[model samples]
Target chain A: EADIYQTPRYLVIGTGKKITLECSQTMGHDKMYWYQQDPGMELHLIHYSYGVNSTEKGDLSSESTVSRIRTEHFPLTLESARPSHTSQYLCASSDLTLGAGYNEQFFGPGTRLTVL
Target chain B: AQSVSQHNHHVILSEAASLELGCNYSYGGTVNLFWYVQYPGQHLQLLLKYFSGDPLVKGIKGFEAEFIKSKFSFNLRKPSVQWSDTAEYFCAVAPSSGTYKYIFGTGTRLKVLA
Candidate 1:
């Protein structure tokens, strides 16, 4: 029921290959985030953007990079994929409001990347 | 560093049983608490959040959480859980002082048997 969307629900690529995961939202949200999660595990923040042209690294260290040229588009790219990067990449967006007022996040379907 | 802790790694319950998942955070100043749920084969969804006002805050799907500043805890509770409640739950917190970055816990897996 979320407005966010991610392409290639499942992906499998060999090591050293380049890959890019797509994320977009129609909600025009100002804050976007990229979280890495195992099949049924906790979520680790990898990247986030406050708005267009503003991107910051999250709590977790990631080999991938992201760009936020457009408000609705925030794509993540990996220069060289590794097996360690095999995890579900979840994209989410939320309002920029400070507190309360349904600060809930709307998550996309998620991209399951498998680097073999 | 601000961190969130979920005491239960795995929880099992029968249909119509009550459910409560404990969440605690370590931060000296003001904080923002949140609970997110990820259903089987689905992305994470917000369950509830606490920013200000009353200590107890309600969320979607009959879920609620209480933020006790003195205890520095925000525990998720459901009076009655259904089989559809089987999923992974994560607790996160954002320090009131800094940006909108969040620190999340490892998460708790819940299994509701029909």
Candidate 2:
């Protein structure tokens, strides 16, 4: 089983309320990613971190910001949440072992956010 | 821009029926293919992955996928599916070089009736 964890599996809040989704991994992975997925839709990468203090934006443009101060933790914060930001946020971590060009990612239970 | 495609959006089958889900990618270079399963209210887990050597790779729960380099396809199959196999299946492709990003399909929702 993967040690990746996401807090607030389900969240409901009003528009303009700032929220922070927590994601942590005990595996000490070097690569951590955050994706936004809608119901019955494909997951779109929003943010990713190669290692500590190395953060990059993914294919999808997201209004949220992320910080990777610690290797194990990658938290995403929305300054002013909107209804359009209400989607399932999934956290994933992967370790790039020697000779493995692309490693399989271990996903955490996604945080489903709803904005009213 | 590399992308993954899953033709089947939704599939329904009875117990003990054979299953096949199609997955095609746009990348022509060396790539790693993966199939992930997400059960109801559960996290996405790796069903199987194909790196090299074997064109056919078997995964847990009797799931198998064949990597066709010529066709740029990696399709998932199962001989007999059970009710517990009901879940959403996603196909992802990652190129060996250039970028570390993985492209994922829209996902196929499988429903098996017991």
Winner by TM-score: 2
TM-score of 2: 0.98
In the predicted model 2, the residue pairs found to clash are none
For candidate 2, the TM-score of chain A alone versus the native chain A is 0.96
Worst 10 residues of 2 chain A by lDDT: A94-103
lDDT of 2 by residue, A1-116 (tens): 54999999999999999999999999989999999999778899999999999999999999999999999999999999999998999999997777756779999999999998
Q: For candidate 1, what is the interface RMSD?
A: 2.6
CAPRI tier for the interface of model 2: high
Candidate 2 chain B weakest ten by summed lDDT? B94-103
List CA RMSD, all candidates: 1.8, 1.0
Q: Among all windows of ten consecutive residues in candidate 1 chain B, which has the lowest summed lDDT?
A: B94-103
